[model samples]
Target: MDRPAQISDSKLPPGNPWRAELRATASLAWPLILTNLTMSLIGATDVLMVGWLGAEELAASSLGFNLAMICAIFCMGLVTASAPMMASEIGRMAHSVRDLRRTFRQAMWAAFTVMIPFWIFLWNTEAVLLFMGQVPELAAKAAVYVRAYMWSILFFLFTLVARNFLSTLEKPIWSLIIGVAGVIGNAIFNYILIFGKLGFPALGLMGAGIGSVLTNMLMFGGMVLVLLFHPKFRRYQLFGRFWRPDWHRYAQLWRLGLPIAVTMGLEGGIFAGAVLLMGLIDTASVAAHAIALQIASLTFMVPMGLAQAATVRVGIGFGKRDPVWIQRAGWTSFVLGTGFMSVMALFIWMFPWQLAGLFMEGNTPQNMEVLQLAVSFLAIAALFQIFDGAQVVGAGMLRGLHDTKIPMIIAAFGYWVIGIGVGAGLAFWLDWRGLGIWIGLASGLGIVAVLMLSRWMMRERIGLLPAQSLSKR
Candidate 1:
């Protein structure tokens, strides 16, 4: 079977394999980068709008959003297993439409499976927060936001499946278009609902939640329509046999996806823990942390996009049993990912105040204090940007080879033991407060980056590669 022009390496310029890989990786990465940016913008817009309600409101909403994100990110990691699975199948046989469809279908099933329990957990957000030692008042307000926002999780998961499908097929432009539209739509809805514009009652924090749910529904609906009708994607019939089960593929998804989910949970959990920690410190600390974290997260989206691109590119190489291609793909993404983040680090370092200003307005004494703390946190984030980029991309590269279990362990130790442990000690034991938490975050990311890159370097000796690729080498 002839591979499609996009999947075949033969068309790469013969005399410059590195340059060819660079071009290929960049072409796939840019749209994904933009898509991730736009997606982050949706959240940032919420945070920005919510900031207007007051510091306590901002803190409460941030807590609610972060808590919801911890669950969503884990579930997303589970479904994302399909990306590498589909990419490798495409590499092995370009026209493996049935295999692709089954993988996608099972991934959606996996998403639905995980969403049920999370929804139950989110519905009782206030109880959980209080149990975790959050202030009763803030917890109650957060619950109000979460109850409305939680409904978006299912829609978001469905959209992720569709986005991963398009991304694996090397057609991520559709995701970018949809994401850009989502940002605009989300902003408009948030304004209308939160501020009570256009004859709608001002719902405040709850309004932000409702706006997100509506935006996610539209995005998911748009993605399904595209998959159903787009000439290229329609042939796969992703929704065909919607009720059928492929037990083997479903099991495989769980096997591969569970570790990925755990890895994401460990990482996202540490950040959520940080928010909880901030909540303990003070309302102002929680608000400042949210601003700084949002800025860091926005920049992190670029490397995340590169990481996603790396997963697909390397998965394709793995399918072809081509170690050299895999190396080229992985290394190309590493260089691009780290290089972009290095520049962003400098920008953050140089302009922390300006970046912090984007999320909050007015220079009242409380705002001024929060602004100062945010600036300090940005400095720490800048220092860790490269490591953050490296670790995420390295994880993506390994994931392409279907090596997730060890990374899960690595994340467990790095994020919780090293990241949170060090952070807690410094914050409380040493009286370093919020700044200490930021330092701990940087430390964990640095450690994880080194470990992930080291593992990638020894992939062959350690048997991370598929048996076929090892034998081929």
Candidate 2:
């Protein structure tokens, strides 16, 4: 619960701005990275526990979970609006307690407002899955899981908002601590509920879903307790007017958040869509694609955390009306993120077989096919890892400037038009199969990365900087 200095980056000593920015960004980023990793572990635990039930149950839960995540990840992105907004406030005024509280409140308001309709949609998961041509039995089982897991979204989104609140204030260690606790709790709950331990009835997928709900609730509850009692955070009084109306701020949150949500959805959807394309190739491709994608995603957590840090850092610079500071902060994160991914890409390139084998091992014909395909996919994934990191971190940099509308449009064109369109044409028409899909994905990410970077470079020219910052120049 250490308190960050009540000073902005614009006030940093001039002799070594890059080093200072790097240190600041790294310190803020590592806890957030560990926090993200821990959250991922929570999901991994659920998948692993449900997997033990049987292949059918595992597949059903995966369907239900992925569907829920589409909505959940979008909502999470929406609530993320609070981070940059709050960070800017902090930069504008060292002690922006009331402003930060207002943002947090509106973020929570926005989260609840957006999640209700999604809850209704989740309740009808079976019909949706059936409509999508999933097996009827699997769809039915998925529906059961969705019914129980949907309730977790609200708490999860709330926890995310709370995490942003802490991150903006540079006190994200609690988030990591709570997330680690949640990982352990989720595993234990899944074991008990899924296995009918301690007299609990074996509810199968239903139990796994319930375990998710309970874990999210506890996570959110832990965040609440920390905010209420922690000396560093209590001063903000984030919940002081929980029942009060702040329509202006609430609307503002939506304006800023909606595009971000759509941007994130487009990125997330393309990957989900890639899975569908893999399914068309064959079950083996789907399985192999899963392994490669999982490794890519796990490695991605590093850049993702750096991206979050960039948003805060650049947002602070934006608030101070210091374009120089903004550039320094953004590029520092960009280099760190891309540099980390380059190393990851090289490792994946050098050890694709070893990494793929971590998820699947055996020399049976089916296993070997999966292993070979996974290695192939990872090879392509390795090539694009840097671009993938660049695009995400680039998006983060722009988001800090509150420039999301155009990025949303770019994501649509890149992910859907170039990414999916090219992939579909190549996989089916060109007959390159899964490898074709991977190339298309790489193309999309590279295009988006270049576009995003161009925007950042031309930010001043394009009038993205604040009026005051431009005037100051």
Scored by TM-score, the top model is 1
How far in Å is the alpha carbon of 183 misplaced in model 1? 0.3
Tens-digit lDDT string for candidate 1 (1-473): 12442554665878899998898888888999999999899989999999988889999998998999899999989998998999899888887889999999999999999999999999999999999899999999999999999999889889988988888878889999999999999999999999999999999999999999999999998999899999888889899999999999999999999999999988888899999999888898899999999999999999999999999999998888889889999999999999999999999999999999988864799998999999999999999999999999999999999999999999999999999999999999999899999999999999999999999999888987777776676
| Predicted candidate 2 versus true structure: per-residue lDDT over 99-182, tens digit per residue | 889999999989999998999999999998778767777779889999999999999999999999999988889999999999
**What residue pairs clash in candidate 2, if any at all?**
none
Q: What shift in Å separates residue 272 of candidate 2 from its native position after superposition?
A: 1.4
Off-target runs (Cα >4 Å) in candidate 1 are: 1-10
Provide the global lDDT of candidate 1 against the true structure: 0.92
lDDT of 1 at 89: 91
- Those runs of model 2 whose alpha carbons end farther than 4 Å from true positions after fitting are 1-5, 8-11, 361-369, 471-473
- Taking all chains together, each candidate's TM-score versus the true structure is 0.98, 0.94
